[model samples]
Target: MVTGGFVVDLNKPLVSQVGHLGEAYEEWVHRPIVTKESPRFFASDVLEFLTLTVWWAVPLIWLPVVCWFVSTAVQMGFPSRQVAVTMVCGIFVWTLLEYSLHRFLFHIKTKTYWGNTMHYLLHGCHHKHPMDGLRLVFPPAATLILLMAFWSLVKLLTPPSVARAFVGGGLLGYIMYDCTHYYLHHGKPTKGISSNLKRSHMNHHFRIQDKGFGITSSFWDKVFGTLPPTNPAEKSR
Candidate 1:
């Protein structure tokens, strides 16, 4: 049965999807199970990935890596094992980044002007308008600005060459996080590693937003004492 992916599709343009393979449509064509017409935006002949999803990703797909390479060259540091480590860690680092951003940046309930403004801009917009696909991921220009800021910080803390690796890794983490987050909210969860990761991430949307803030892993939550409570009952299978 069709399970997840763009649950309650909202503001989604015409999408070309087979409504639940066969069973769902058979019910629609015959039985017409109307438990109350949901606001869910499915049932269309046009393609969703092409129409609604793919266009939202164009800026992310080509924008960051282009900047990463050009910036790396300009920084005068030859890529090395440190760079490789950064790439590996960069992917893992996104979990921490995600956790921190969600817990601190997004979840800020401060009454102060700056803090409340930041919370609204960074995450409140997404929470209120989750289906604005283009707005879901960090835009290219904003991402570049962040990359510059992070690179500056890394450079101040290390040598040029080392900083290159460190910053590159961190940037890599951001790219992965943005992409995965977008895909999690947009694409269908498959049946492998991607599926597992997608489900784990999507749980944040359903169960508890305040907890389980890691996108790539629970590593950060474990580190910071924010991991969700144990649920052995669901895993008993």
Candidate 2:
């Protein structure tokens, strides 16, 4: 099916549609489509709108939730030091989780029609249209669902106070990620860490999708041996 000029077959695997050998598929999928607006995803206007999220909405919607988690942890008699420690740990954990999900789930090769469709909706579309501002950040509706699952998992593994603080920190990390991602795409970072991050992420989108999966920090990519080539000559090659 073609939606907003992008062809997507919901009934067949992407590999089959592009080429059986997968070489053509790789080139096609990695090629970027720059556009200001996001493509239509659902026929229903509301559903399509729900899929398009502005970068600011991420922090606006989730910041309060993070505050609530931290405040609640304090109310529950958790010491400030413990709360701080857990929250920091949560933020640290999010960086790893970010790297894992980007490298594993988002980039997973799929063979079935449903699998391909899900992958496209989840991450492929972003790759195919890397400059679509509306699609840079995760939509609030989908994020809320994931948030619940993460909350449940964390709660099960830890006490309530700890979970709350940890989740809060994770949420903060997510906020930084979304904002940084948007800025990397649209904002000019002429120097320092922001500049380096923008270059690394842009290379991931335009040069090598398999490497530099870390958005907030390239430390994980360095640790995992997935850091993209840094040599100017290598990058050109």
Candidate 3:
């Protein structure tokens, strides 16, 4: 079915329909379509709008949840030092999670109908339309679901107070990540780390999708040996 000028067949795998869209699967997925608005995902306007989010909404929605987590840990009699340390550890854990999810799940190849449809809805849409400002960040509806799952996992593995602190830190890390991701797509950072990060992410979107999966930093890409080639000539090939 066509929605917002993009074709999607719910009964057939998206990969199989690429030729009909007039591009090879790889080329169509990697070639960015510049647009100010996001494409429709649901027939219902309300449901479709729920999938599109502005970059600013990330902090506005999650900041209070982070504060609540940290404060609850403090109220549970965890020492300030312990709470602080656990929170930092949580942030560190988020970095690794970010890298792994991007490389493994978001970029996973699938040919089944549901697999391709879900993949397109989740991440492929962003790759196919890299500059769609409305879709640059994760929508709160999707994020809340993942946050609940991770919260349960953290709480299960750690003491109550520690879990709260850690989750708070991880949530902060996510906030930074989403904001950084949106900025990388739209902000002009001519120098320093921001510039480097923007270049790395742009390469991931336009040049090499399999490499440079780390959105917030390239540190993990370096650790995993997935960093994209630095030479412009090599990238162009």
Q: Would you estimate the TM-scores of all the predictions?
A: 0.62, 0.87, 0.88
lDDT by residue (tens digit), candidate 1, 130-160: 5456556765555667778777776797777
Clashing pairs in 2: none
lDDT tens string, model 3, 10-84? 444343454344323434566677776565566666767687798999999999999999999999999999999
lDDT of 3 at 41: 60
| Candidate 1 vs. true structure, TM-score | 0.62
Whole-model lDDT per candidate: 0.54, 0.82, 0.83
RMSD of each: 11.5, 4.4, 4.3
lDDT of 2 by residue, 1-237 (tens): 443344656444342343222323344556677877566666666767777888999999999999999999999999999999999999999999999999999998864556656777788778877989998999998888878988999999999999999999999999999999999999998999999999999888887788899999999999988988987456532
Question: Candidate 2 regions off by >4 Å?
Answer: 1-26, 232-237
Q: What 10-residue stretch in candidate 2 is worst by lDDT?
A: 15-24
With a 3 Å backbone cut-off (N, CA, C), the pairs that clash in candidate 3 are none
Model 2 TM-score is: 0.87
Candidate 2: deviation at residue 63, Å? Answer: 0.4
| lDDT order of candidates, top first | 3, 2, 1
- Tell how far residue 216 is off in model 3, in angstroms: 1.1
Question: What is the Å distance of residue 231 in model 1 from its true position?
Answer: 4.5
